[model samples]
Structures are given as C-alpha cells and as structure tokens.
Target: MPTHHIVSAFDEELKYLANRIAAMGGHAERMVDQAVFALVNSDHGLARQVVANDEFLDIGQREIDEKAIVIIARRQPMADDLREIIGAIRISGDLERVGDLGKNIAKRVVAVTEARQPVRLFRGIESLAELALTQLKDVLDTYASRSIDRIGFVRDRDDQIDAMYTSLFRELLTYMMEDPRNITACTHLLFCAKNIERIGDHATNIAETVYYIVTGAQMPAERPKEDKSHKVTAQATAAADPS
Candidate 1:
C-alpha cells in the first residue's frame, strides 16, 4: 500500500469520528433545549419526545465507541492521532451524560407541572438553561473548529452558569419556605436547575478535552467554579441581608 494512501485513509477516519461527535453534540444540545422548553411550558408531550430522543445520543456514543476501537486497532494511532481519537470518546461520554441529565429533567416535567409555582421561577430556569446551552454550543464549536483559542472563554463561562443556578436555588428555597404548597414544585425545579448546572459542567469537560487534544496539556489544577447552593441557607441569607 502506498504511504500516502494509508495517511489518507487515516485522515478520513478521523474526520468521520469528528463529524459524528459534532452531530451528537448538536443532538444533545437540542434535547436539553426541548426538555427545558417542555418543563417551562408544561408541555408533557415534548418532554416525552425529549426522553425518547435520548436514545439517539446513547446509540451515537456506542457507535463512536466501536468506531474508535476499530480505528485504534487498525491504525495503531500514536501520540497526537491517539489523543484525537481518545478525546472523541471522552467527549462522547460527556455528551451522553448531558443527554441523560436532560432526560432526567424531562421526566420531572409532569411532577413540576402539577405543583403550582410562580411563573418567574420557571423563567429563571429557562434563562439558566439558555446560558448553559450557549456555552455547550460554544465548546462543541471549539471542538469542531479544532481550535483552542475559544476554549478558555467557554470554560470560564461555566462559573456564570453555576452562579445563575445558585441564585435560582435560593429563590426557589425562598418560595418553598414562604409557602408549603410550593415545596413540591420548587424541589423539582431545584433538581432541574442542578441538571442544567451539570450540563454546564459537561460543557467544561468538553472544553478541557479540546484543550488537551490541541495542546497536549491539561488545564490548570483549579478551574473556576461558583456553585454555592450546597452552602446556602434561608437563615444565613436573611441574617446577611442589611436592607
């Protein structure tokens, strides 16, 4: 076999892997979008559809896994080539988890819809999901572009998603505390919000994967994270208020 022909085959295989990952990324992002829309709108059917679409991501991950294993065995890829293929698998795992998180939120739509809560709370969740989804798209774009230039920015925005989720957490707790009737719905919303936050985390994971594939170096020891929901308490919030 001609050396150039072998190199061409290798390049084509890598391209196929990247294209598949990009397709999965878009599908996962859409699932989250539709899931959040359904939750906010109380659209049970769309929520169900989002749940159903999760299987596509699952299948995509499996296909990528098989294709990557074949490529590794056939090509005996090393160094940078190995990293690219391995990175795709890692990103696929993250994307699959993101899809699972979206499905989890979708499953709660019925429960959240049953418990009456303020419209503003749902709006807050929608806003947070939007931010996370945008960042997810950005990180996926970085992966497809094969550029590390935008990865740092995408990674930094994960903090903003955390802060937004934390803010929504406090607001939901305040509503639940103010009215016992709101607890059921607010609790479900809290879970949904956490899922969105986790999606942001997955986006960051993809960004890190992109950085590693491009630069062959791990990100710094500590990445910015601002989620404070676990530490928050109504009593502390009230005590800290000077107004």
Candidate 2:
C-alpha cells in the first residue's frame, strides 16, 4: 500500500512538471509570433513588450528546475519517470532559449528600422516565421499528446525551414550587393532571420526530447541539414558566375 502511494505521488510530481513545460511552450510560441509581427510591422511598442515579457519564461524554467531537483532527491525515479523529469528540464531549457531568441528578434526591431527596406524582405522574413512557429506549435502539441505519429513530420519540417532561410539569405545578399545603402536594413534582417531559423532548431531539439520521453532511444545522430549560407562567399559567387 505504501509503495503504491509513493508511486502516485511521483506521478503527480511528473504531471506537474509536464504542465509547467506546456505553459512555457505556449508562452514561447506567442513570443516568437509577436516578435516577428513587431519586426514585420515596425511596431516598436509590441517589440518592447516582447522584450519585457521574456521574464516569464525565465521564471518558469527556474521553477521547473527547482521542482525537478526536489523530485529527483525525494523519489529516486527510474526509467520513464527519470526520462520525464530529465526531458522536462531539457525542454524547459530549450523553451527558455526560444524566449531568448524571440527577445533577440525584438531587440533588432529598432536596428532594422534605421534603413528603409522593401516590403518584400519583411514578407520573406514573415514567411519564415510562419513555418518556424508552425513547427514549434506542432512539436509542443506532440509533446503534450505524446503522439508518435506527429513527431516525424515535425522533425522533417526542420529541413524545409532551413531551405527557406538559405533562400532568404541569398536574396538579402543580392539586395545588399545591388545597393550598398540597403546593407544596414538587410544585415539586421539577416540576424532576425537567423533567430527565426534557430527557433526552428529549438523546436527540433524539443521533438528529439519528446521522442526520448516517449521512447527510451535517442534520435539518429545525422539529421538532414540544408542551411548553405556559410558557403555563399564573394569568391564562390564570382566563380559560379560564368559570364
């Protein structure tokens, strides 16, 4: 009887951790959306609000960590319980980083506003955010449901986000090269785009953690990576231009 009671208490503790993680996930997703919206619309007020709201995620993480440590010390969980606690810590950390990424984008709103950029660039950035935020929301749903069916699709979509980011990277470089005056705006947009791409990355990391939580195995080490921005160099572009 006492053993069953202890197990019940442990389960309750795990549930608490899961609930905290879900709250953090939802808050982080909203932050990403608002940050992108602020950047695209040049809404300085909304951007400032996002920068201020990051404290919620930080506080949530600290709370989860503190609870997990107490549970670990008291319960000595094994197998799935251990995975759940560990995964909660990891997921919370990723969500916190997502919040930071969102904050980073918000911080750049003012910088990107210094030079006048075309609407197309902002649209391009918005499209990338849409995809990334979709990935994030889907993965969070998968985590909540523990549905294996949704996991693969979420993981696979990371490549799509990477490809889109690469396309944007190329287009931004072209604009900067075409007009030196656009450099300031395009450069800030580039960093913002990178932050959106990283939000996709954190979503992918959460997908892997979800997989681990549901299954005991780690995901395959080699996931497909399509971001080729590093190879886009002046010399490389010139060499490829066989005029």
Candidate 3:
C-alpha cells in the first residue's frame, strides 16, 4: 500500500475505534440504569439480565484493544497519533471498570432480593444512580463531540454523586445504630451506593481523559466550592435555602 493509503487507513481505524468506545459507554450506561431500576423496583428479571449482559461489555473492551494493537503495529503511528491510540486504550479500560461497577450494583440487588423484611427503601441509591447516569451520558457526549466545556460539567456533576453517597452512608449508619435488625439490609445498601458512586468517579475520569486529548493538558484537581449565601441569621430566619 502507498504511504498516503496507509495513513488514511490508520485514520479510519482510529475513527472506528472511537465509535467502539462510544458504543461501550452506551452499554455501560444501560447496565447502570438497569441495575438501579432492578433494585428500586425489585425486578429479579432485570437484575438477572444485567448480570448476563456484562459479557457484552467485556467483549467490547477486547475489540477496542485488538483494533488499537492492529493500528499500532501496521501503521506505526508516532507522536500525537500514538497518543490518540494510547488514549483509546485507557478510555476502554475505564469503561470496563464502569461496567464492573454496574455488575457489582446488580449483585447487591440480588442480595437485597434474598434479604426478607427490614428492607428499607433505597432513596439514596436512586439519587446516586441518577447522578451517575447523567455524568456517564455527559462524558460520552464529550467524547463524541470533543467538547471541552462538557468535560467541566461532567466533573462538576460528580460532586453531586459524592454528596449523595455521603448522605446515604450517614443515613445507613443511623439505621444500623437504631436497630440491630437494620444492619444487614443497610450494609448491603451502603455497598450498592458505594459501587454506583465509584462508577460516577470513573465517568469523571473519562471526561478528564477527553479534555487531555483535546488540549494536551491535564485538567486541574479543582472541585466545586460550597454555596454559603444562605447563612442562618437570628432575626427573621429564612424559610429555606436554595442551592
């Protein structure tokens, strides 16, 4: 093949690899949403389906890796092209981790199904799942569009997931303290929320990777600051504080 043809083929491979990554992300998002839906609705069938679908995510990760290796070996891309190839590898790994997290959440759903009585409603889990889903979608969008602005939004949304996780932990701790009977169910709920929150973090990691690929610069470690405009005053206490 001519040199021009080889470069064109290499570029095409990179494009296809990116599409595969997006497909992987889409599957991961579905896994998470299905896991949460199962937990909240106590749908045994959905939980089982999520467990079975995990294999697809694994297959996707493998495909992306295989294609990347083929490109590296055949094209021998250098510099920025090499970085793009490596970045796809890293992104696929993160997507696999997110898939694992979803599977973990599904396992927790199975545990919840086994436990009879003392099953508290999983409000915290629902909130965390929603936040994670939003972040996951946003990150995938950044990847598709190569938009730096969306990356910042994805990172900012992570704070909401973390706060929900913290709140869930505190609530579960209270449950465990109040009634020893609550310990088993609460512990499982805690683990489920933790898994979902970790998934959100992984999504943020992807967003950071996207930013790096676009600008060749790492995103800062900065976090969103708390809004403190609603300080309670002794005189005429405010009815509420809106974030």
> What TM-scores do the predictions have?
0.92, 0.92, 0.85
lDDT per model vs. reference: 0.88, 0.88, 0.77
Which residue runs does candidate 3 get wrong by more than 4 Å? 1-6, 115-120, 223-243
The TM-score that candidate 2 achieves is 0.92
Task: Answer with 1 or 3, whichever has the higher TM-score.
Answer: 1
User: What are the clash counts of all predictions, listed in order?
Assistant: 0, 0, 0
Residue-level lDDT for 27 in candidate 2: 92
lDDT by residue (tens digit), candidate 1, 74-140:
9898878888899999999999999999999999999999865568979999999999999998998
Where does candidate 1 clash, by residue pair?
none
lDDT measured at residue 219 in model 3 versus the true structure, 0 to 100: 89
How well is each residue in 82-121 modelled by candidate 2, as lDDT tens digits?
Answer: 8889999999999999999999999999988766667988
Q: Candidate 2 — which residues are off by over 4 angstroms?
A: 1-7, 235-243
Report the error of model 3 at residue 54, Å: 0.7
Candidate 1 to truth, TM:
0.92
Worst 10 residues of 1 by lDDT: 234-243
Worst 10 residues of 2 by lDDT: 234-243
C-alpha positional error of residue 41 in candidate 1 after TM-score superposition, expressed in Å: 0.8
